[model samples]
Each structure stands twice: as structure tokens, then as C-alpha cells.
Target: MDGKKKNLTTSWGAPVGDNQNSMTAGARGPVLIQDVHLLEKLAHFNRERVPERVVHAKGAGAHGYFEVTNDLTQYTKADFLSEVGKTTPMFIRFSTVAGELGSADTVRDPRGFAVKFYTEEGNYDLVGNNTPVFFIRDAIKFPDFIHTQKRHPKTHLKNPNAVWDFWSLSPESLHQVTILMSDRGIPATFRHMHGFGSHTFKWVNEDGDAVWVKYHFKTEQGVKNLTEEVATKIAGENPDYHTEDLFNAIGNGDHPEWTLYVQIMPIEHAETYRFDPFDVTKVWSQKDYPLIELGKMVLNKNPENYFAEVEQATFSPGSFVPGIEASPDKMLQGRLFAYSDAHRYRVGANHNALPINRPRNEANTYQRDGQMRFDGNSGDSVYYEPNSQSGPTESHQNKQTGFPVSGVAENIPYDHNDHYTQPGDLYRLMSDDERERLVNNVVGAMKPVESDEIKLRQIKHFYKADPDYGERVAKGLSLPVPQNV
Candidate 1:
């Protein structure tokens, strides 16, 4: 056998040193924009599909207001949350991940929960998912992970083998894969599930003191989920069931709401925290950092035009409004660029000019002239920030209270490696009935995976989470329990 291995290279043929993790200031990083490998990879991934989004293509949106109930001026200087009783206009979009524009609403998939708050400073988008944890923590593997979830290359159909194989090999996916196969996987309606920012972010007070924070939007309507049989039946009966429910509920004045809560950890606590605070695959326990009530978001108005308001709407987690800043979370750092790049490619460069995305304060950037530059390209103003013509001057008011960087730049993995403890803890918290349903649901999905090796490998992950959880899934799949996991 002739053995000739090759180094992995970028598009221009430069050999890559680290493809799994993006280049950062340090191992735990606020990802540098200079990571052209990341930018190029994400840019290419975003452009793979045109017009419609590559993921989250099927979605529904509504108008709402966020009413701050608790004073968080001590935690953050973000104007919207600075004063109690302050209200800000906002919009929210809900979508199913890995689904096409015409896919069913009741699929067993993660739901996108993106909110755009049009604050006085600018638009701040909290782009997240219904689940508080994610499948993977690194963004470089995102495109590949999504590929596994999408149609097979040769068959053009969903491949269970690829899905299970990828999830098995990547043990980091255990937390999210567990939740995705549990009762909460198929939410009863858009109003019934909780939403989470999922990534740890930074919050700065007036004193410029920063803290690591996680956001939770607890559903006021209560968390309700549909069983697999019911969800399957509904998917067959009405693919737009969720869309209709949201629109009708809002129209009939049955407004649904969620109380915004956050778990705030002091900045210094991050380095000493048991798990990687920035890892999107794990959650900061309420015990360590209790949920602090912040505000309430009430969605009472349905979109007037689906295509104009909902379809044309865009969001990016990088859209920040001072005091609120990005953390060193690798997945989040990748998303800060990926989401915006995706919007630019899928909805054009000037897509933000649309009413749905246009900020209340509007933008004052010198960057101009693409398709649909309808705002007169700044109208005779100088096209540079530091121009003598006084086009626009830099406002240092919104600077991040950035932390100091340490350690050499390398592809170091996250601080925590024990992924099973959290998932196991979550399993133990569930009731007996919930545990049974979780097992049955996970087993049902794994049944389509033909490879015994893949099946066993995944069972090992379950075993690692909880022995009972593992054995039940194994028995349901009619496979012998994995030993010595």
C-alpha cells in the first residue's frame, strides 16, 4: 500500500495549524477578526446557500416590548436595562434549525430564539436557541456538524448514520443531544418553551467592572412539550402549526410572555469556575449563580406581512449596545462574525437598512454603497470616520471593558473536560416519567442509525451521563449495554 498523507490547507493552499479552534487572543479568547481562516470558512459556509438562510430558513416573528422590572445599573450600563420600568421596542424570531423554508414546524430539532432590541444606542440582538446548551463549543466544526444534520450528499435525504456518527465521535455534543431527544425537544407551541442566550457574555457597569453572564428567558406561559407520536401526527397534518398558533394567539390578544433572567458570575470567578464558563455545551448552575430577574418580554403583535417583516428580518449576536459585550467563548466568538456575514450574504450588504432590522438610532458608519443603498449614501458627507469634513467622529462611549489577555496563542481546548457530570446531573433532576420518555425518544431516533458501532459509541455517551439512562436506551434499541464506559 502506498501511504501518502497530506497536511490540511486553507483555500489558498497554506497549511493550517489549527482547524478545530479559531485563533484567539489566548486559549480562552475573544476571537480575533484577523483569523482569516475562521472568516474565510464562515464566509464560505454562509454563502453555500443563497437568498434563504442556510439554517433557520423556516421561521416566524413578532413585535414586542421589553419592560425592565429590576434595576441592573450596578451590573451593566446598557441603557435599556439601566433603569427600572424602562421599556424598549423589540422584535423576536423563532425558527427550527436544520429545516428548509418549507419544513414542518414540529420537527425534533433545536429552535432558534433571536431577539432584536432597538435601543437608543443601536440595535442589540440576542441570538440564541430554546435550549440553554449547544451540541458543540467550537465554531470551526459548525459547518460540518450542520452538514451531518442536513441531507446526505448522494441520497439528498436525511442520513441517520451521519447524524449519529458525528454526535458519537464528538462527545461535546452529549449535553445538547440529550436535550434534543428529551421531552422538551418538540415544544408544544412557540409560547411554551424557554429560551437561552446559551453563550456566556460580558456585562460592564458604569465603573467599567465586568462580569461573565448567561441569559435565560423563562417562559411565563409555562414549558410544555409534545410527545413524539403527537408531534409526528401534527407534522403530517399541518406543517405550519406553530406559525398559525403564534399569529392567532397574538391576534386574539392572548399575548405570550417570558421573564428575562440572568446568572451573573464575577469576572474573576470565570478562571476559577469548575467548568469553562464560556463553553456553550455546558450551563452555569443556578446553585452557583442564581437566576436574577431582569425584565419581561411580551409579544403581543403579529407581523403584518410575513415576507417583508418576518422573512426579511435579520439578527446577529455581535449587535451590542455598550455595557453588554462578547466573552471568550469560542463558539460565541465565531458566531459574532458568522451571523453578520450570513445576513450580509443571504440578505445583501444593505439588508440592515430594512425597517425590520434598522436600528432606532440608525447607523452612522462610513461604509457605503452596495445593492439597495436607499439612504442616499450619507448625502454629501465625507465617507471616512476621521474626515476633515466632519462626516462622523468616533464615539468612544461604547467601548468594551475588556479584560487583559494571557497565555500564548494556541489551539488549547476548553478548561473543562468532564462533560458528563452536567448531563448526568440534569438526568437525575428529571422525574421517573420524564426519564422514561427521554429514553424512548432517544432510542427511537437512534433506531434509524444502521451502524452498530455508531449506536454503541453513542450509548457509551449515555452511559457516561447516567448508567440507568444508558442501559434503558440500549435495551430499547435491543443492543447489549456497553461495559466500562
Candidate 2:
């Protein structure tokens, strides 16, 4: 575009004589060690790939800004939402969970909706999914749950027996399984679906008052999804359909936006709530706790480099600012450590120093040398705090508010946990047609299971949720409905 030709140079700016041919003995013998250019090129090529993510590996990202539409300082002391019309630059990555880097975008899997806000205090990451509920509430079950979703080790193929066996045994998975089998499982595009902070979080105001909140990013473009038939066809035709759609939309200046809403519950309500407030597999009734308008997020810029800005960009639920904090959700609590540890291993120890992952404000920490310590290693400053040297100190104002706890340190299940009511209610609320479609989807997904016991066990759970639901699925699977059920 500049209409000028430039010479090629090595990484260190040294000019090259000829790249097509390497230095060799007698021009036809083995290559010579004197070929520094050949060695550099081969070495760099060998290390080109970083390790892929354990989950949500296939993704698309964009640059954007979040503008507060209403003042929420009464609930959260976060500066980005301190006043009306305040805009904070942000980045978002929309991904498919349980997929590798080359998976199809239209697969029947939960979509990941993670956001990183470049705030004055620090980088605040909200890692979530499109659905409001998940398969399991406890993090200890995560590895096993994911193993079922992935290819079997022996067969190297998707195993329906493994999937149905796990889901049948874990009744808590029914809620998410039902949703995934429905039409909403395959979103039409990244811009056409809703995003959610599925885990409950804590918002602390300046007065140290904390409230439990759940975030919902309702799509302004409206919800659109692909049917099972269409999604399958598109997957074969264009595996990168969602990624291409997002890029084209932003490039054509038709930016997509989502309105941010939060369901806030008083901290006192946790004790008496019908369902566990911190459970990842449950949802709060909107009638009891309504959504409060927060702001709007608009993605208007596409990344110049997909590898640098999207693939290498890392986020973790642990990256919290001052006003926002973690809840007692077991799954979320595990992610606070798991996500960052995975990033450190997949990327590098200094992954935060990457431009795409860096915070807007200067990072002040006593952390010293690690792999890829790029920020000049903090310019030789004192690496430890509470020393006799001039270094950064802790802020008393940013201390987390303490909550009382009374429990023995042992592996125990939640005392008042009930995994059925909410999912039952969900089934009852669906229309006759929706219920039929759901039953059909479930039957189709479960038909491949080799175990009759697993099938009957899962059908029983469906029956417990709703008799009609169980009966329909039983008919579809050609299995007789149990008289006891």
C-alpha cells in the first residue's frame, strides 16, 4: 500500500543475502553450521505453537467500550460504574466450550463469554458462559465432567456411553443438559446470543456494604439460534461461521451491542433462600430478585492480529478489581485458581505482560523474575514489601470485608441442597411445543448409550422433573415407562 519496497532482515535487523538457499558443503552436501539464518528460521518455526487451552480453545475476540447507562455506585464502588455515562475500554472473547482450536463454531456446546475491562484500578475479568446455569456446582467434579465431553482416550472419538453415564449419575447436570439439547444450543452467531456471568459475585460499595449479584448481558441485536439440522449443515460447510460473522459485522461498521443487567440480592437473603445462592447449577427467580440496568457494551473494533490479540489474550476470574470480589460458589472458587494456573502454563509465567492482557494502569507488585519477564523486571525496584526501601505498600481501603463462617473443616455436602425444584419449574414453564422439542433432543442424544441401566436412571430423573417429560422421552427411546415412576 505504501508503494515502496523494503528489504527483508533477520530478527536482529541483519540483512540476508539469500533465503531460498542455505549454506552447504559443495552446494549439494549436508548443510553447514555456518548458516545462522537457517538455524534461526528453523528454531523459531519449531516453537511457533503454544499449548492449546484445556477448554474454550476456539474463539473470536474484539475491542470495545462499556458505557454505564445508570449510576450503580449505591451497589458497587467500582469506578467504571461509579457514575452515569462513564465509559471503560474493554475486550471480549466469545468461544465454544469443549472444543479444540479447530472445532466447528456451530456445534451443540455452551458458548464462553469472557470480558476484560481495562480499568484504572486494574484488569477485571468476568469469565462466564452463555447459559445461566452449569452442569455441576462443585469444582471437584469439573475434571470428570470435562473428560466425558472430550474424546475418549482409548477410542479417540466422542463417546456417547461416557457422556450419558456421567449425566445419568449426576442429577445436577439435568438443568444444563436440557438447555443444551434444546434449539438454543447452537447459536446463530456470537452477536445474536445473550451472555451471562453464570456465577454469583459480590459487589462491595464504598460503605463496605456487600450484595450478591448475577450479571446478564442481553443482546441488543436480539436472540437468534440455529436448529439442529441447520447447525449440522453449517458445521460441515463453514466451521468458522461465527468467527467470520463477527469480524465482518464489525468491519462493515455494524457494531453489535449488549445491555448489561445485574440481579442483586441482599447479603442477608442467602441464609433463607429456597435454593443455594452460590450454586452454579441453579438460577435465582427473576420475580423475587429483578434485574437492575447497569450499562451497554459495544464491540466496534476488530483486532489487527488474531494471534496476538485473541489467541494469546488470557483472562481469569481471579483478576478482580477493588469493588468486585468472589462469592462462595464452589465452582467459581475453584476457577479463581484453576484458570490462572492454566494460563500460566499454557501461555507463560509473565502472560500478564502481553499487550492484549495488560492493564491500562501501571501494575505494582513485588513479583520478580520468571519466564519472559518483559517489563524490565520492574526497573530494579525493591522486590519485597515492608522493607526499609522505597517500594509499594498495601492499601487498607482495599481490604476484603470479612464474613462469619461456622463449619468443621471436612468434605461434606451442602446441608440444605435441593437439585430438583428449579429444573422442575423450568420444565413446567415451557410450552407444549418446547417441551416436545426438548424431549426429542434428549432422546436423540441419549439413544447411543450402550447401558440400559444408565438410560433408565436418566429417564427417572426426567420423570422426577415432570411426568410428561419422562413419558415423551421414554416413547422416543422405545423404552417402556416404569410403573413405579
Candidate 3:
């Protein structure tokens, strides 16, 4: 039927040798900046949708404050966390991962939980999701992974074939996929779900000592969710149910609250940890490193103007203060660039100049005018640095923590690629009814995958995670169990 197979190439017709992993300095690395292909793919993905976010397009936001209850100066030198009872004004945006700006609120999707703190040092954003882990580890696969989640190019509609095929091929998605199909997948309300700084980050103290940390925002309202049937009904009946609930709650003075906690890991522990601590797809067991209470976050006021306060508001993982910094999470590393770039493209070149995104303290930069340069473009002062005229200077305290990289720069897969253990452990932790519901949800989704091979391949992942999980879903889908999987 065919004399030869045509090779896949880039937009410029350059042959793509590898389509999976991104180039990095070491096995567990901070993604290298020189990976042009990875950059090109992500940069292109960021701009695909015009005037709206390519992801996390549908969202709700509120005004809040984070109040420190205990001293953490020994762990982080961030001014907001400097003393007991210190409070910092903040804004939080909750969103659905794969939906458009007009999509239903109650759909089964990952909820984005991003917070921007107006600290004296600058605007520090803790951008993450409801779940602690994500579907993929490397940034190179992000564009492709999202493409599978979105509409098919040809049909312009959601395709189960693309979704399950990608998930089955990439077993690293098991942990998050399982969570997505669980009872908590469709939250009853935004206030009822937990939020996480899904990526590991570094918290450096005054002495330059660093510790790897993960952030968790436990909902004071308690965990609540909806079933597929109930959620679907609500989606049809009231598409703005979640949005209305949030706005009404604050208006009635029933303020929503969450307690912030962090799990701190020794900087040296990354070298000897069981799994790559830097991998965003994996989680550090709470048993290994317990949570320490940091602060309380309370949302008391809804945004007055949806377009100005909520829609125009931007949060980027790259916006860091002195003590808080990015870890080597490849997904996080890629996001640092993509988020800011997206904001610049969507919001404008001077997006940061927007009141919602601007720092509480004045910001002065030598870089001048672009689109939406509404404020004084440095007020006719010398725009060039190192000028004889008085000008703002860099802060030495903002220096990054030093770490060594020794491995060859290439597309290196993680050394410890045991993707099943955690999902297996997660499946076993649920009660009988919870497990039943999870299996039912997964089966319903997998039932429409269209390819027997894809279904069988994915079943192997379920089997590896838990025999009962595999058997139940297999029976529900009426598919034969794969042998020796």
C-alpha cells in the first residue's frame, strides 16, 4: 500500500527527530532555555486562541487577604510571611482547565487555583491547580496533551479518540487521570475544593538556606463535589451557578476561607528522594513530609467589575519575590516563560501596568513604551540604566539560589519512571463506594475511545495500579482483560 512513510516535520519543514521529551541539563533538571523546539511548540500553543486564554479561560475571582498565624522567617524571608499576624492583600482566581470563557462551570475538569500576593517586594503569584499533581512532567508534551483535551482540528469538537489515545500512550498521566475521574472531579462549588501550588518551589531564608516546598490551601468549607448526572443537569439548568454562588456568598457576608499549609523538604533530600522531587506529575507523600500551617486566606469581597478586576487580572508563575523562587520542575519551568508571554500577548506589552497586576509599591523600570502604555513611560527620565541621572537599581536580595548541573543537555527521561505505585496507592485509599464511582466514571469516559488497542493499553495502566480497578472498568466497558499486562 505504501513505498515509504512520510516523516513528521516542524512548520518550517525541519524533521522532528523526537516528539516526546524536552532537552534538559540532567536527568531531573530545570528545563534548559536553549531547547528551541520546546520553546517554539509552547510559544505557538500560547498564541493559538486570540483575546481569550488558551487554557483556564473560564474562571471566578475575588478579593482576599492572607494572614500569617505563625513565624516562618526561619524558612522564608518573604516579607508577607515575616511575622505572626502579618496580613497581605491578595486576589485569587479559580478556573476550569480545558473550558472556553463561555463553557459550563460544573463540568469535570481540573480547577486552576491561582493567587497573586501584593507583597512590598513586588507582586508574587502562586499559580497552581486544585490537584497536587498534573498529567505530564515535561513541557514538550504540554501542547500535545492540551490538544488532546481540546477540540479536534478537523471536526472542531471534543474527540475521545485523541483523549484516551494520548492518556494511554503517556502512562505518566495515570495519577492525575485517576484523580480527574474520582468523586471530587466535579466540585459542587469553588469554595468547597482544595487548592494547591502543584509544582515544588524553593523557599530561601535570609542566610541563603533553601528548602523545597509545596503549598496546599485546605478549604474551610469542606470538600464537596457533584456526580456526572447532577453536574450535567446543573450545567444545562444554570450555566452560571458557580459564579452566582460565589458572588452571592460574599455579598451576603458568608465569606469563604482556606487555611494555607506547606510541606517543606530539605534541599539535599532531592538528591536521594525515592522519586524525582522536581517532577510535577509526582507528589511527595505527606507521610514523608508533613504539612506545616502557614496562614489563612479569606475571600470577603467579590470583584465589582468582572472585566476590569477578574478578566484583565493576570497571574504568572514567573512573578517571584526575594525569598520564593522556582524549583526545577520542568512543567513549572516552561510555565514561567509561557504565562508571562501569554499575558503580554493577550493583555498587552504593558499588561503588568494594569492596576490589578501592578505592585502595591511603585515599580520603576528602564524599559519604556509599548501598547497600553497608559501610565507615565518613566516620566521623561533617562530610560537607560547606569545613567548619571538618578535611576532605580537592581536588588541584590533577588538573586537565585545556586545549584549545580552536570549531565549532558539532551531529552532525558526521568531515571525512576515508576508511574504506577502512587496511583495504585491512591486507588486503595478510597472506600468501597468511592472506588465504585471512580471506576464508573473512568469506564464511561473510556467507553467512547473508539480503538480497542487504546482501551487495552490503558487497561494495563489500571491493572498495574490496582487489579480491582482494572477488572471493574474492564467489565463495565465489556472489554476482554489483557493477558500478562
User: Would you estimate the TM-scores of all the predictions?
Assistant: 0.89, 0.98, 0.89
Please state the error at residue 379 of candidate 1 in Å: 1.5
Q: Please give the CA lDDT of all the candidate structures.
A: 0.92, 0.92, 0.92
**Top candidate (TM-score):** 2
| Candidate 3 TM-score versus the reference | 0.89
Task: Give the runs in model 1 whose Cα sits over 4 Å from its true position.
Answer: 1-50
> On a 0 to 100 scale, what is the lDDT of residue 78 in model 1?
95
Q: Per-residue lDDT of 1-485 in model 1, one digit per residue for the tens?
A: 46888889998999998999988899899999999999999999986544888999999999999999998889899999988899999999999999899999999999999999999989999999999999999999999999998999899999999999999999999999889988989999999999999999999988888888999999999999999999999999999999999999999999999999999999889878898898999998899999999999999898888878898899999999889999999999999999999988878899899989999895888788998687787787778766677576766766677578889988888767888998999899899999999999898888999899999999999999999999999999999999877
How displaced is residue 137 in candidate 2, in Å? 0.6
Lowest lDDT block of 10, candidate 1: 385-394
Show the colliding residue pairs in model 1. Answer: none
Candidate 2 residue lDDT tens string, 254-321? 99999999999999999999889998899999999999999999999999999999999999999998
**Candidate 3: stretches off by over 4 Å:** 1-50
lDDT of 3 by residue, 1-485 (tens): 58898998887889988889998889988899988788999999996544988999999999989999978799999988999999999999999999889999999999999999999989999999999999999888999999998998898999999999999999999999999999989999999999999999999999999999999999999999999999999999998888888999999999999999999999999999999999888999999999999999999988888888888989999999999999888999999999999999899889888889999998888878898698878787888888888788877767888988898889887787889999999999999999999999999898878898999899999999988888888888899876798
Model 2: worst 10 consecutive residues (lDDT sum): 413-422
For candidate 2, the per-residue lDDT at 342 reads 97
